[model samples]
Target: MTEETGRTVKPGRSDSRPHEDLKLQLPSERRIHTQQPMSVTAMSRRLPQLVRRAFALAWRVDRTSTVLLLLLQALSGGLGAVALIATTATIGLVATGRIADHFGQALPSLTVLGLATGLRALAGVAITGLSERLAPRIGREGELTLLEAATSAELAAYDTPGYNDKWDAADRGADVSKELIGDAQNLISSAVSLLAAASVLTVLHPLLLPFLVAASVPSGLAAVRSARVHYLGMLATLEDRRLLGLLRWFLVDKTTADQVRSDTVADFLIGRYRQAGARIDRTTDEAAWRSARITLTGALAGGLASLTVWAVLVWLLTSGRMGIAAAGTAVIGLRAAATGLQGIVGFGARLYRLGLYLDDWAEFVELAGGHRIDRGTVRPEGPEQVEVRDVSYTYPGADRPALDGVSLRLARGEIVALIGENGSGKTTLMKCLAALNLPHGGEVLWDGVPTRALDARAAWRRTAVVPQEFARWPLTARDNIQLGQSLRGGDEAVLRAAALCGADEVIGGLRSGLDTLLAREWWGGVELSSGQWQRIAVARALHREAGLLVLDEPTSDLDARVEHRIFHSLRAPARDRAIILVTHNLINAAVADRIVVMREGRIVQTGSYTQLTAEPGLFRELWLLQRDRGRLPVQRTTTDG
Candidate 1:
């Protein structure tokens, strides 16, 4: 889902017209477009920053390798210069017009030239070896860095406007981080070669240096302009590309595969994919046309400049301003300079564009995607009591608050059931209580200390949550229950938790029992029914020794017998932890020591199930409706706090 303009566009949902928002005119995109027809001055200003970032990233990944590769490139350039000088000496001796005498005189220069060329080739090989070794390590490091920053951000940041857009862009940058090393190396190599060639040309004839610069300037400008066009196009198509990815996921993901086939929506999804792709293609085509035009213009200008440089060389040689040997060497220097210039311009352009994407990555990392959780340092082992004092929270772009001035308390040895209709804030209140969502107004306190003063990670370790949509991790059955926290009893603890949630039966039937992988996509792995997965999720929470246990619609997928057994088993765990249960099913609420009936983000009534049922309020009203439908038996036992 893309969050923009203070709202989220749900996946697969778009404007009535398929192409309505395909071409984004975001501030970032607009800025890139406005900077179009990129000038030499602007490119020169930007190139150094990109180069520095590239080298910095490479150096961080493998310091010794990065230094070695850089030295090899510099040595290659120096060798090229030495070889050129040696060529000049040989040519000058051979130009004496005395064949046998000059041939003997040229042998030493020939030996020097051959030695430099061989050494340069060996250096190139070493450079390639170092780059190859560094690329994957660099790539992994880049991705790990991005993941660390993303994981540190607050959960609410995912809902903030433009956050997902920047995330997607940064993600793309991380995907190609290895290429940054190559681009940086090529830029350095080309730059060094350009300098070497220019130095030779200046030594041969002072005027030749000016002609070399003149010939290179146009193509360099064109390359920069082309890169800008490509970057701008990427910005324009960002949303469409994301949309296409969403469509592709829907088409291919196992979760949606059955629905697509059974509902015969494959064609519809394909059509959406086609439309999104077409939109991207249009932007890409426009960019290609613009780039082609710039390149053709540059080529034409460069061709004319090259002709002028060659004419000047011939004039110098004819006028005796340059000798036969010097002119011959000048020709070789001219070709070397031209090749070096092309490499510099071409690689520099690519490096600059990739840097734009990397800039997004760097910016996101620095800001922690704009909403990193910055809580206090005080760590709490567990909460004996959690108090909510008039806490209120409103989601971003929301018309109404999800929770408003709601006060409640949870303590150890108590099972407090929060009963509410959809959108009545039971889940939100639970999240606030767990410190997952800090309130905008008032505060939640754990053992007399405000949640804001608690170290977020440390506090979270003391809370176990089972939401309506629980994660189905692709791990071993035992690992799923243990969740990397092995208790003193090890397998015995896992088995006990599984037994409590009735997941032992599910595990027993698996091919590898506790060691069985949960994902069916892998060999020797298995998939579970929705009810079975719920059992495993419950087992996971039960296994964790947390202070607060928040279960939202935990029994939604369970059978009646399992649901009853699970709720009845809660009391044992509640003795050590504060339990907050949220469910629409009134029957399950009967298991709680205290029942809180919420309506429209406010607590309307609070009492024991029997006490609430005796009164004529929202709780009784809901009970009667369910009791009449035979969904709730009138003779269910109630717990006393």
Candidate 2:
């Protein structure tokens, strides 16, 4: 068990305690698939396709930059070849002792060499500038595309474990776009350099080509093996990494700052963070050792290959098959070739490794794109009548349903209260009514037509919801309320809504009133209490001017006086709008025109508060419980009204 926010958490139910799961061993059944790393052959086979896809994406982002980058790389390669030829000529000319005769040839060779060097340097500079300009655009485009897919997907998509795993993978993958672009640049440069070296070496001697290949083989194999090991290790610890990140946030963020210190769980949290860090350290160490062993073996093989190549070059010179000047040129060519080969091999390995993440990004985008919510073309005005017809919804991978075969109707100009215990489907039902979640087995009809037939965005515009977990936007109080009615500009309406929810008082007390920033982390910003934030959320919802207003525990944090004022103000809106209020506070529900009592996943009773109090049901039992606890006023009983 763990202690958090002065509450005890039981085993297997650590949701209440932030980062508690980081300290516990996850069950085997809960683990995601632990697959083996791809072999070198598999990675090689897929590299070309992945490279093509990545290049296509980059090209689409900025054509001019892509073309310029390729041109620069190609020009640099041409300069490298010219420099090698000039070096060979200079070496051959210098071999002759007579300065007067050789001066003509050597001077021109030196001039050509200088020109090649200068051009290559200029190209390199241009490449760097272009890469810097292009990388951010590529990253932004990729991230925005991924965001579009994520935001357009149905709400139910987030409930599945598979979707969540893919989403995380995609988020990480989005970062790879910038890295992949840089890798592609390296890859092009290296490929061009390798080709230039190979061409120059072949001109010197055909036998030198094999030596260059031999030199690159061992290191290339080593890099591939290392990449696989590292990638697999990271994949194995992905969940741990996520937990570690969360633990770090909990330790540092303002949201958990008070609870962590007040509850005195800082030491416990830090211990868990260290443990997670240690696990990652162990995994990394093991992978590094494995890679080191493979690299050591490859180094030995490469050394032997290099020795054989040098021996053959010596034999060629000693046997008079090659002149001293030619031998010198051969040596220079060999060194350049080896360097070029190493660059190509190293870049190839990096690209292949990064390709896996890029593939994940691609797959996630495709999957999410396919599952986009098709908000139909039919625009919906404020719905006068909404009906839930035998609706049922079960979360992904869960055996039990969150909402069973339940049906209800809501009409404009009436206040309907839904009261139930925790996990009694109150929240789920409210989400369905708001058109956020589609029922699995039935339909939600707006104006006697299925909601699926209406434009989702348009339908959502007609509804306002104060969710149980309302977002505390870190903007000015005025901006927060304005966000609800973004299509309109009504400073008067904003103030009126704030007044209705008693949020006007909260704003007036602020250092800058409506203009004050809500985030404490920012300059001249201040954080409000939970109750104050709830009032702001209420004002935001009320400002929407939505015909259907769904409030799920909207007053859960308000004091008695504030709660009374808010509930009383809700009555004025109820005259033209349909209000569905879900709360545990029975006193608030008492004023509702009609109360619907729910138990488990089903609505067990429906009647006015007075009618429910006189009956023997869950509603009566709950009211008596609150009354005995002195939470409900004794004077406001069924006997009075």
Instruction: State each model's CA lDDT, in order.
Output: 0.87, 0.83
Q: Return the clash pairs for model 1, or none.
A: none
Cα lDDT tens digits, model 1, 1-641, are 33444445556766332434533335565376446666678767788888787778888988999889988998999999999999999999988888687787899999999999999999988988888888888788889999999988887787677778778877888877888888878888888888898999999899998988889988998898988898888887888888887888989998899999999999988988888889899999999999999999999999999999999999999999999988998999899889889988999889878877887888778777787789999999779999999988898889998888899988998999999788999998998899988889999999989998889999999999999999989899998888898999999989988898899999999999999999888665899999999999999999998999999999999999999899889988988999999988898888899998888888989999889989999988888887785655466567632
The alpha-carbon deviation from the true structure for residue 182 of candidate 1, after best TM-score superposition, in angstroms, is: 0.5
**Model 1 TM-score relative to the real fold:** 0.93
Candidate 2 per-residue C-alpha lDDT over 1-641 given as tens digits, one digit per residue, 9 for 90 to 100: 23545566566765554543333332243233225445567656766676676667779898898888889999999998898888888888888778778898799999999999899999999998888888888788889989988987888887865666667667887887877777778777877877887888788778878876877788788888888787777776777788787889999888789999999999998888788889889998999899899889988988888888899889888988887777787787788777777776677777887877766677768768345787667877778988999999898777789899989999998899999999889999998998888888899988887877888788888899999889988798888888845545577788888999999999999998888899887765889999999999999988886889999999989999999999989888887788999989898887798998888889999999899999999999999897795655466668775
Q: Where in model 2 is the C-alpha error above 4 Å?
A: 1-40, 369-377, 397-399, 484-489, 629-641
Stretches off by above 4 angstroms in model 1 are 1-37, 630-641
Q: What does the lDDT come to for candidate 1?
A: 0.87
Q: What is the lDDT of residue 595 in candidate 2?
A: 96
